[model samples]
Target: MLRVVRIAGPATLVGVGFAALLVALAIGGGAAPQLLEDPGAVVRFGLPTSTMLVNLAASGMIGALGLVLFAIPPASAAYGRALDVAAGSAAVFTVAAAFTGFFSYLSVTARALSFDDTFSQGLGQFLTQIALGQAWLQTTLIGAVVTVLCFAVRNQTALFFVGLLAVASLIPMAQQGHAAGTTGHDAAITALGLHLIFAAAWLGGLAVIALISRQIETPKLVDIVTRYSSVALICFIVVAASGYVSAELRIGSLDRLLTPYGLLVLVKVGALIALGVFGALHRRFVIKKLGDTGRRRHFWWLIVAELAFMGIASGFAAALARTATPVPETVPATQTAAEILTGSPLPPELTTANFLTQWNFDLIWILVCGFGIVFYLMGVLRLRRRGDRWPWYRTVLWIAGLLMLFYVTNGGLNVYEKYLFSMHMFGHMTLSMAVPLLLVPAGPVTLALRAIRKRDDGTRGMREWILLAVHSRAATVIANPIVAGVLFATSLVAFYYTPLFRWATEDHIGHEWMIVHFLIVGYLFVQALIGIDPVPYKLPYPFRLLLLLATMAFHAFFGLALMSGTGLLLADWFGATGRDWGVSAIEDQQAGGGIAWSIGEIPTFILALVVAIQWSRSDKKETKRRDRNADRTGEAELGEYNAMLEKLAARDGR
Candidate 1:
């Protein structure tokens, strides 16, 4: 079985992916019409084929880098081999992306090939000047950079950035796919982006491990395989989830499941389920007994089968990228300026009644908040099952935080935020301030540490990672009260006064990034103040109080700056919203400042009160400790002090 797998694994991967692509394309009509006037069969079929290679190569590069940085030790021979794999894969990615770009240009423009100066100039202009061409150009450049970095960089810790760059290189491809100029574009981008990341991790990991399996010592091989398996498991879950999302965006409804594109999706789904089962078998039987030669033999065969299935899934995905969806993504016409800017029609003017009803759901945040509530409940249940006590209020606070987060991101606030600066700021405050205030006290980290059983295996489990993160030097620095306080206050100015505000408002990626930044900054600040999660260290009560006061003062100053301002911050977006129902955008800006000042202070006060209570409790605890010491010794120290005083007096008399 081992010999068979060793020989057949890579071949099976390519073959299965190729077969799956061919099948899916035949079903979905991926072939463009072979017109007499158009570029010939080479160009026609070569485009999709190039795209499929690009995906495969990209997955290999990203997966290898991730495995190196996360699973394999830097000192191991396998680590260097993994880098070699990444370098090779990245080279392929770079080449394939460039070809895919050229093919894509040909597919779109339907021009004949030429190597003349005019052709060169036209190609340069297309790549350098156009958005669609630029996306591929950027991807190619990023791939090239990652390829070089993989070869040049050997430090394991620094390779994380390389992995990030590799993953990020896929974003442009996602953007260039069939999602643009559609209502589901955001969903498509998100789902596609996630799919690419997880899929790369899954596919690339197997390839790297298979390539380097012999070089790894038997002892380390087991550990590496176990870690990679963990990564694969997570990848499976995320891939499945993201696949569902992407399918929904493209397939639209279950009624269309019988359509060619939907059938392709079903095929991909089946492949994923098979991969999941393989992962489970590996985890249950093989990973636990890697030292057993017989078990290891079976594992290699299982890995080969898993690779084949992964290839099928990847092939289907590549074909699906080429396949046309049944529903038209294009809107008939958007007449309004807001529609032109935002891609959606201008919502009905904001009304009190609509605050409860209006919604522009962010699929990502909904999943996030939903998972948050689910996991927290799961932790609580785990604790209860083990006869452990967790504070009910902490659970309540966590639920409230997640619910509020969901509402802020997906409800009335999100609906109006694009057109209303005030609402955007309100959402920002809730995200960065109010939500953290609720969430920090929930002691999520503490709960996790207490609830998650420790893993003694060489693999770093979730609990280990959490502990490492908290105790890490980076955490220690960021968790510094001064640093957290400064960042919390300075970010508002930095964000609003720079291009960041514009980007956050204008782009979906930027918007999501903005939410994440706000939430993190808020959590850091609140954690510095009154977080129940154990940290590297804490400041004294007086310093904490001082820090809170200083933060509030800065907050007030920021509000005043906004309130006294005559110019609108985002005049272009909010100013031109064309709403007559609400107060003027400038007035709304001032009102946002007022809310930032007043409503913001309420949370500050709560923080201050909590800090004061903690201070009092600390003093009481100290007093009780001293009293207990006195009771234990019965004032022996006091008698010694009197005797010392008497001896001093006698010496003075003499």
Candidate 2:
């Protein structure tokens, strides 16, 4: 029994807990109130919502358990294998749980009875409800199976399968609340989902590493921890950003951040910061001092403590997910259609002339900023003589280009309005096209190095600081492929699916987040595609090409989905007004999605072709150099010529 407990403990505990919750909900007849018009019935049951809360809590607990189990070090080789099996089984169970809960919610809500009458429904209806909930439960189960299978396998090929399964599972889960109409609801849900996945990866990976540290020698432990630090930093950023977006959307007002949900979120954020601090300690002190006597146990304790807090935070997250969204009183029922189009409401006179006048001031400033950066960069380039090294000037030019790109993409117009397809198009181009192309060539790390080199190198203090910043673990992490890809992909997923898009159009705060997202995503995608700086782990050219192709295909599919969508997924925010742009709402939306699909391909294809050409050229040059070296005279008359050739080869490599 003790052995079984250790082998199947996490899965058994989570499964039994989830099953008990479901049984309790069914026995108490709590399913009916969710379908009611009044919210009071759910409150009466001490649940902020109906059985949805119970289901969500169960799912959260299962997810948390999976995370914990994944973190724990297997006691032995057999235990490790059993843990893998248990994880797979638990994932399968989760899928069933999701499906059943979904069906239950659907069946309970489909009944015509009010909130009071629904809870009073007979047992047969409840059981029928359980059948419908199978969809998501199955999906979750499949995802778990895939994750466990990934661990069981040792090949890179398995990663692709795991990635595919993960993406498949998230699709239905993300779409579940699509009908909620509230922009905040969509944003919060999407952000929360992303946060959960990222958290799982970070916490679970850390647990694995911690367990490994105990078993491996000090040197191997240091290497593993060092490698993982970069991943953790990226995850930290994702958690913070997503958490903030979710909190802002759910609270809907600055004042409500002090409320229960907000305070809880703050606590989670605090916990994350604490985790970061511990991570820093691991990097700065623990890992370096691993060879020291008696430090190994302390490191293990720190990791365990961090994992426990992460688990608690996950639970609080479950609670927070069920909390009532604070509705702001000052929000308008329907904003002026003109406001949606032009980004601001029309003047009191309400004439076309008045509308134009009101927006002119804002538009002029936007144009000034946009055009100013472009021309300034052009001027800087013109000033530099051909073949003269002006790395700093080039850096400034790229920075200027980025600023202008931001202005056009995010600053020029209202992103949330229905009819602002042109503005959205402009922003998308900057993010997916212009910015990536420009920044890729600029090479941020190389430029930073040049800038640091130009500083006072003679001063030991300043030089040390510069070296520290450039060679830091933080720098290395940002430059990792996995870290960069996750950040890039998550940004796109968060933007399209969440209320973040809608909220940005509704308020100033949302617009700022949009700008930040565009910049970060744009930077990551560019760095992935054509970075010149040192990346810790670089994918093979073929793999990079495949990743690029896959990303493009996904974007194109999303665009097609948007274009073909019968009902408005985002119509409320992006629809057009008659006075501006002259396009109908559906036409504008379809056009935007179509452009997103069609225009995206050009840059991708161009980049792929460029990479192929460069690779081929490099291969040819390498072959020629190898043949030349083979025929060279040994340490005689050709010494000077060989040195010259070596220098040229190095230049070519750069």
Candidate 3:
């Protein structure tokens, strides 16, 4: 366990350190510019021109190294050698790009002097630098192709397919950089590049470990897997830390979170937490019984669920890379002074707070209607559980209480525009955090099963329908990670950036969508995490960690981009107030983005650590169990036949 912990520690440290550095850069990098009287002009003309060239070179090299690593084959002993080369190259290039981008940003902004001139100059310089960086990135992609060629030379089919998918994924990366027309493309590029490499390490390492475990014919296999497990754990930590930093930098404002970008971040975070829980459960329950026949199905199910979530996370990441970051509304110092003298009036829309105020009236209606129906259901359940005289009133009251709780939690309706940052945060907490915990214990599946059993004799159609609904492929797919992640993340993106966010703010229709989307996304995210339901795919632990990391990175970048953006993407909606509250629009945008990127990491890192610890403990416990069983047998060579008889007898006794 100590050795396992040691192995995982460094990788996590490296990842966390890197993430911290990135976050620092995003937040502090703009401080100088914000303090200037004419920050825009300073950024445009005051900064130097050479920094762009350096950044371009650095981005190119890092991208190239990533490509090369992806191209190498797992079957070859040379695989590690190739990866070393790629890592070395990427390190060199990333350092160069980071310095170059930093210097260029500083020079162009001139610490926020000569605002107007700097703005134009800085924009041009930044663009040029990005173009160069893209060039390097493209070259790195070519190197990846070369690595794929090497895999082909070795006739490695698995490596080839992995390479192919890696290559295909690059399309979204390339498109996203330019598609949004946002100036934060450099940061986005860096985030995406790092994310890909880290993901590969995590997932690839897990694959290696799993393969090694399966091939273990002797005690040596245990040591080999233990070593590999350590590596995988470290990789997982890196993925989580890096992802957190990136998301914090992308989200620009609290208001923009209601937009697609914010919602997606929430969904991703939820999914990650869910995945961690599943990993813990698997390590605790399944690992100890690895060789037991009765537990094989459960083990397989857990694995499948993990993998399915990983795939879903991967797809969501792809979508995230393309989504636009939100820009915060700038409240200038001059405007702040004016607002002090003349206070602003609240908007006429019925906000979330308003809905809370009408709670009593809503509750009365819910109690009357909800209790009436619940009473009927209780009478039915009681009839089945006990013949006729079973405390039916008590059961009815219990049902009514449950409905009251549900109504109180979800009955509130709020207009989108009226939602303040605090309220929005509260809503997200309820959906992503509170709701998941409640639903998990509710055991919807178990409840449905019980209900069906009770109703089956008299209500054959209802039983068959319930069974079919649960058994259907469509239901299976909906419960799958891919569908869940996509639905959750996509809802966030679609609702926020498009007219949907504003519409939801304007009418009751939008509120309904928000509620539905949250519930669905929440359900999916939790299900993916706990893995109580059947999942069609199974990802190894390392792979799940990698996917989680990648998803977070995408989110961070999204937030950072929003924080750093010069113009408001949602200007028409947010700009109407003309209230620049002492900060530049871009600065506020960056701050909000940073918030999203940074906050999500705490839970993510904790989850990763828990997974590693759990896995290590399980491995040790299983080894000890096997040893004890061997000792108990006392030199008697037990064949499969004898083992089966002993297992049956033990079960009968239990």
Which candidate should be chosen as best, given lDDT against the real structure?
1
| Candidate with the larger lDDT of 2 and 3 | 2
Per-residue lDDT of model 2, residues 1-654, tens digit only: 322333332333234334433333343343325544433443433331322332333333333233223222233342254335334534544554444453345444543334575454643354444433444555556656655664564332333345445544543444343213354433544565556556655665554453333345555455446556655776776777677766666676888777755666676787788888988887788767774653466666666666656654554554453444565423357875764444345334333453333321122223334544554445445445333355574566477665655445433233333245544754665665666676666664553443332323121222334455556687578656666666655666677778877776554336546765676666766666666765556766777787778777877777787688656546655543534534666666677778778887787887788678767887899888877775775545367778899999999999
Error of 3 at 60 (Å): 68
Q: Can you write out model 3's per-residue Cα lDDT over 494-548, one digit (the tens) per residue?
A: 6657887776544333444565567667566545544343455544556556645
lDDT of 1 by residue, 335-370 (tens): 577766776777887888898899887767877887
Give each prediction's root-mean-square deviation over alpha carbons: 3.2, 14.1, 24.2
Q: Please give the lDDT score at residue 447 for candidate 2.
A: 38
Better of 1 and 2 by lDDT: 1
Pick the winner on TM-score between candidates 1 and 3.
1
Predicted structure with the largest TM-score when compared to the true one:
1
Instruction: Tell me how candidate 1 scores on lDDT.
Output: 0.85
Candidates, ranked, TM-score: 1, 2, 3
The order of the candidates by lDDT, greatest first, is 1, 2, 3
lDDT of 1 at 83: 92
Write the number of the candidate with greater TM-score, choosing between 2 and 3: 2
